[model samples]
Target: MKNSTPKANFESFSFSEDILSAIKAMGFKKPTDIQLKTIPAVLEGKDVLARADTGSGKTAAFVLPLLDNLSNQNVYLRRGRDERFDSSKRAVSN
Candidate 1:
C-alpha cells in the first residue's frame, strides 16, 4: 500500500517568527521521518509516541509546535529576565 502521510514543511505551518528563525538557525533543512510523523499529530493536540536515532530532528518536532502554541496564546518564554521584552513575551492570564 502507498504511504499516506502528507509531506510537511516549516513554512506550511503557522509558526511564529522566533520559532521559524530558530529552526533556520539550527540548520534544519526539512523534517525527518520521526518529525514528519509526530509534528502534525502533536499540533492537533493528539498524543504521540515515537523513537528515532540521535541527531534526528526530534527536538524540533516537539519544541516548535509547543512554542507555536504558546505564541498563539500570547505567552512568550525566555531564559533570561535581563533581556528586553517584546510583545511576543507578554504574559497571559488564565
Candidate 2:
C-alpha cells in the first residue's frame, strides 16, 4: 500500500512512547522503503503480504509491528503442571 504522506525519517512518525523509546535506544534513525510502507498497515490491523528484495529491511517491517502488538497486549505467562497427575497412568496400568 502506498502512503499519501511523503516519507520522512522513521523518527518522525508518531509511535507509542514506549515503542519510540525502544526504537531510539536501538539506534534506528530512518525507515527503509519496506518499513515505511508495511509498518503502518500492520499497525492498522491489515493482513499484509509483502515482497521485497534481500536486505530491504523486511525483518524490521514485520518485527516492529509485531512487537508493538505484543507489548500492547502484555500477555500472560504461566508454568506447566506436573505430568504425574495424568489419567492415562490408570489406563496403562489396567
Candidate 3:
C-alpha cells in the first residue's frame, strides 16, 4: 500500500492561514489516514463517522477544521454513539 503520511499535507485541505500556521507550529508535517479522510467532510459541515487507532490523530482530524469554522458558527460535533438523532429521525419520518 502507498504511504499516505508522506504525501498527505494539510495544505490540500484549504485550511485557513491561521490554522495552517498553527498546524506548522504544532509540527504536524503530514496528516494520518484518518485525518485525510475526515477533515474535508467535517469542514464541509457534513456529518462524519470515522474510526481509527487511538494515536492515529483523530482529535486533530476533527478539531482543526472545527476551530477554523468556529468564526462562522458552523460547528456541530456529534459522536458516533449519539443515537438521539437516529431516534428523532425515525420519529419524524414515521
Candidate 4:
C-alpha cells in the first residue's frame, strides 16, 4: 500500500475567505513542506511538535490553521466597541 500524501496547495486547506485573502495579499503562493504536513492535524485540534530552521514558514504553518479554526466559530461579536474573541480556554481582544 502507498503512504498517505499531504495536501499540496493552500487552497486545499479550505481556509475561510478572509484567511485566503490575507494569504494572497501576503504573496504566499503555497504552503511549505512543514505546513503541508501539520496544518490538517492542527485544524483538527490535534497537537503538533515541529522543528524547522528559521524562516521555514513555521509561524504561518500554525497561525493560519489556528486562525481558520477560530474563524469557523462565532467567537467574536459582529459589531462592538470592545471586540473580543471567545475560546474554550480564554477570550482575547479582536
Best by lDDT: 4
- Identify the candidate with maximal TM-score: 4
TM-score, each model?
Answer: 0.70, 0.68, 0.66, 0.75
Cα error, candidate 4, residue 92 (Å): 16
lDDT of 4: 0.79
In model 4, residue pairs whose N, Cα or C atoms come closer than 3 Å (at least 3 residues apart or on different chains), thus clashing, are: none
- Return the lDDT, model 1, position 93: 40
Q: Give one digit per residue, the lDDT tens place, for model 1 in 40-71.
A: 78888887777889988788788889878876
lDDT of 3: 0.74
lDDT of each: 0.73, 0.71, 0.74, 0.79
| Model 2 per-residue lDDT tens digits across residues 4-80 | 56457765555666777888897887888888888888878898999899988898888887776766674544324
Worst 10 residues of 4 by lDDT: 83-92
| RMSD (Cα, Å) of model 3 | 10.8
Give the CA lDDT, 0 to 100, for residue 27 in model 2: 83
Deviation in Å, model 4, residue 57 alpha carbon: 0.6
lDDT at position 1, candidate 1:
18
**Residue-level error in angstroms, candidate 2, position 89:** 40
Clashing pairs in 1: none
Give all candidate RMSDs, comma-separated. Answer: 5.1, 10.2, 10.8, 5.7
Rank the candidate models, highest TM-score first.
Answer: 4, 1, 2, 3
